[model samples]
Target: MTKKDKYQKVAYYPGCALEGTGHSYNRSTKAVGKALGLDLVEVENWNCCGAMEVKNVDPKLQTYLSSRVMSTAANEMDMDVVMAPCNGCYHNLKKAEYDLKHDPESVEVVSKLSQKAGHKTYEAGQVETIHALDWIKDTVGEEGLKERVKNSLNGIKVANYYGCMYTRPRHIFPEKDQGPGSESTSKPHFMDDLLAAAGAENVEFPLKTACCGGAHTLSDSDTSTKLVLNILKAAKLAGADVIATECPTCHSGLEMHQIRAEKVLGETVDIKILYFTQLLGVALGLKPRKVGVHENVSDSRGFLKERGLA
Candidate 1:
């Protein structure tokens, strides 16, 4: 079938952050899906996909964790596709799929873990793992997004930040960089395309794939602060009024460091940080509150209201 048809009713995996700090993304993603008449059946009894941290302890264990989630979607939910909004979760699930297919050691470990955990072993090719950006861009192309605009994000300058985990060490994501209409790892533009369709003026952002230091935000606060500040400053220098984020860890790091930069370094940078999903929800006529805009640490309510978006 067509791309839209394939993604019309996929299993949703929001991960742990979505239920906590990333609730706004969760809300807006669901809102956008509903507005577009798409069906999102959440993965049943889903658990953590070994989000960026756990893999440091044991790669195979992390593989098993992600595999179990995919197993549930493919075996129990009977779904062919699993959609994850979190970059970490998306990356881990994709990594698991790759490991299970190519590495016999991974297969053996996952099989043993499945038996011990009382679940079916997740073999590769059982389900397709996709990010939220892929879900929107593939299903509702730029043209489709343009047709659904209720309150256009006109004149709102956005710097689309895809973050590092989405595209790094590219072999895991073989689907990307294939041809036109496919995602590019070197210069990803799915978020840029979607926001532009909603009438947002996407700035010339050079740090789209930069690391937000989310992995070591706590362990190495100084380094993460420096990294986040660089991203924020770069966006401002690029004439962006807001930094559009796709990952919860990146979004939180940017917000937290924006404060830290002002308080500790006394380097105040006046740029709002928002989720791309939240901006899309507003453009689709959903109120800011509806998309949990108020929940964000970096307040953009006034700025959005002044632009006639709130």
Candidate 2:
């Protein structure tokens, strides 16, 4: 079938962050999906996908954690594809799929864990894992997005930030870099393409895939603050009024550090941080409150209002 047919309806895995700090992203993603006429079935009784923290304790354990989520989607839900909005969830699920296929040790651990956990072992190739970006870009495409735009974001400047988890170590994401119409890990443009379709001007953002140090944001606050400040300052220097984020960790990190930098280092960067889905929702003529824009730490309602978006 075509890309759109394949991804029109898939299992949605919002993970833990979505219910908490990333609620805005969760709200916007579902709102945008509804507006686009796409179907999203939430994986039933879903658990955490090990994210970046759990893996540090044990790689195989992380594999098993992710395997459980995919197992539920494939075995119980009878779904062929699982779409995760969180980059960490997407990466971990993809990594579990890769490990189960290539590494015998991972297979052994997951098998044992499944038995103990009273669930079916998630074998390799049982289900395909995709990111929210893939779900939108592959299904809707830029042309589709353009046709749906009601309140065009004309003159709005955006700096699309994909963060590190979405496109690092390249091997895990095999579908990317497969030529035209495919996402490039080195220079991902799915967000850029979607935002552009909404009539937003994408600035020349070099740190689109930069690390916000989300992994060590708490352990190493100074480093994460520095890294986040760099990204914010870079966007401002590039003439961007907003930084469009796809991942929750990166979005929260940037917003938290933006305040920290000003309070601690006396360095202020005046750029609003917003979820990409929130931007798309507004462009689709949905009210800012509908997408939970008010939930974001970096208030952008005034900024959006000035541009006639709110």
Candidate 3:
């Protein structure tokens, strides 16, 4: 079937971060889906994707963790597609899928673990994993977004920040030539295209796939702060009022470090950080609370209110 038809309903996997600091992303994602007449069936009995410390410590262990999540979706839920909002989760699941298919060691480890844990082992090609960006972009094209926009973000200048992830070493991403979407490794523009469809002007920001240093946030505070500050400063210099992010870690890192940089380094960059889903929700005329904009670490209600969005 067509992507517009197939992706209308899929397994939604909101990783660990979404329930905590990235709650705004969770809320806004569901809100935008509802506004657009789409359906999402949450995955059952999900687990972490091992994008955190587990991966560094044990690579196979990380692959196992990600495999379990996909296992529940495919084996139990009988799903053909799994949608992840966080980039880390998306990247991890894709990595696990790739590993299980190609690497005999990963398959052997996961199989042994699944047998011991009394759960079905996840086999590759059973389900297709996609980012939330892919879910909406494939199902709802730019024209669909433009048709659904209730409040035009005509005056907003946005700098789209796609974090440095999804660089699947196995080249496991689906073929981009099938009219699904373009998966440009060098410069991904799904976020930019979505915002532009909502009437926002995307700035010429050079940092598309830059690292947000989220993995080093706790382990190295100064380094994380410096990395975040560079992104904030560059967005400001590009005349962007907001830096739109898709990943929860990247979103929270931008929000938290934006505050830390000001208090610690005394470098205050006056730019609002928002999830792209939150921006899309507002453009779709959903209330601020509906999109959890007020729940963001850095408040943008006043800023959006000034522009008649709130």
Q: What tens digits encode model 2's per-residue C-alpha lDDT throughout 62-107?
A: 9999999999999999999999999999999999999999999999
Question: Top model by lDDT, which number?
Answer: 2
Question: Is candidate 1 or 3 superior in TM-score?
Answer: 1
Q: How large is the C-alpha RMSD of every model relative to the true structure?
A: 0.7, 0.7, 1.5
Give one digit per residue, the lDDT tens place, for model 1 in 179-262. 998899999999999999999999999999999899999899889989999999999999999999999989999999899888
lDDT of 3 at 134: 85
Where's the lowest-lDDT run of ten residues in candidate 3? 168-177
C-alpha lDDT (0 to 100) for residue 266 of candidate 3: 94
Candidate 1 overall lDDT versus native: 0.94
Candidate 3 ranges with C-alpha deviation above 4 Å: 168-170, 174-180
The TM-scores, one per candidate, come to 0.99, 0.99, 0.97
The local distance difference test score of each candidate is 0.94, 0.95, 0.90
Model 1 spans > 4 angstroms off: none
